[model samples]
Target: MGQSAIGTKMITQIGILVHDIEAVSEAYANFFGVDKPAWNWTDTPDKAQTEFLGEPSQARAKLAFIDMDSLQLELIEPDFHPSTWRNYLEEHGEGPHHIAFVIEGMKEKIAIMESKGMKLQQKGEYTGGRYAYFDSIPQLKVLVELLENDK
Candidate 1:
């Protein structure tokens, strides 16, 4: 399998980390037309499995979503846990946290990326899927999130 075998697609969502959920959610709603009940937010799911730096880990974040036709915008406030959201905020001072790509054959994709020198920084799960943060910042200048979902 060559490099292009991964079959990467368009970004499905843009994830951002903010210091204040309500303030940032309201601002995004006002400026970008994020809709009501955007508060369908939640704490880090209990059943969701996660890992960081090759060790089993628990991570938490306050999450809200804004639908924008084909693309979704995610607002994340790092909860008091071990998460990339927390790391990004502490290291980069808050902004776009990650850009996501919904992928097929996710395990293979991850292996390929790693073979090409990318680092697997974090792993997280939600309702129907799991996701990974690839440390592509050195080359792409931003984190690339790959999601494998049942949707």
Candidate 2:
């Protein structure tokens, strides 16, 4: 396979979209024998500066994280507002959403992916970093997310 456009092969996360975060989280906790993590709402559009399909969006989601041995498992329950998460859940139903990588040089990484035919689906800011999701299903069978956290 060609070199990774994002410049690293390590997967930091596996995001899953679900209809009911609370129930799913509980189930996962029981199965994994781990405490159920609390779910929280993602930042508002004003704080996240979210954009979907190049347009500003008011998208948000309830998110929970479960730390695994190697990578983080993310459970997302997106609100009605338009976003990659919402769209995927609406069209495909609940399941794997995207695989994520921690990257530097966000702009350059996005350019490379776009050049390789992976169009960006959504982007937004979080507490101490930013993230962008690309439509890479055609090649990888799932979406790819680039997370650039502050050093």
Number of the top TM-score candidate: 2
Clashes of each: 0, 0
Which window of ten consecutive residues has the lowest lDDT sum in model 1? 36-45
Q: What digit string (tens of lDDT, one per residue) describes model 1 on residues 1-151?
A: 4444457658889998889888888888889764643554443456666777777666777788888989888888876667677888998887898888888777898898798678999886778888889898888888888989886
- Runs in model 1 deviating more than 4 A are 1-5, 40-46
lDDT of 2: 0.96
User: For all the candidates, what are their Cα RMSDs to the real structure?
Assistant: 2.4, 1.0
Candidate 2's error at 115, in angstroms? Answer: 0.4
Scored by CA lDDT, what does every candidate get? 0.79, 0.96
- 66-90 in candidate 2: lDDT tens per residue? 9999999999999999999999999
In model 2, residue pairs whose N, Cα or C atoms come closer than 3 Å (at least 3 residues apart or on different chains), thus clashing, are none
Candidate 1 CA-lDDT value: 0.79
TM-score, candidate number 1 = 0.88
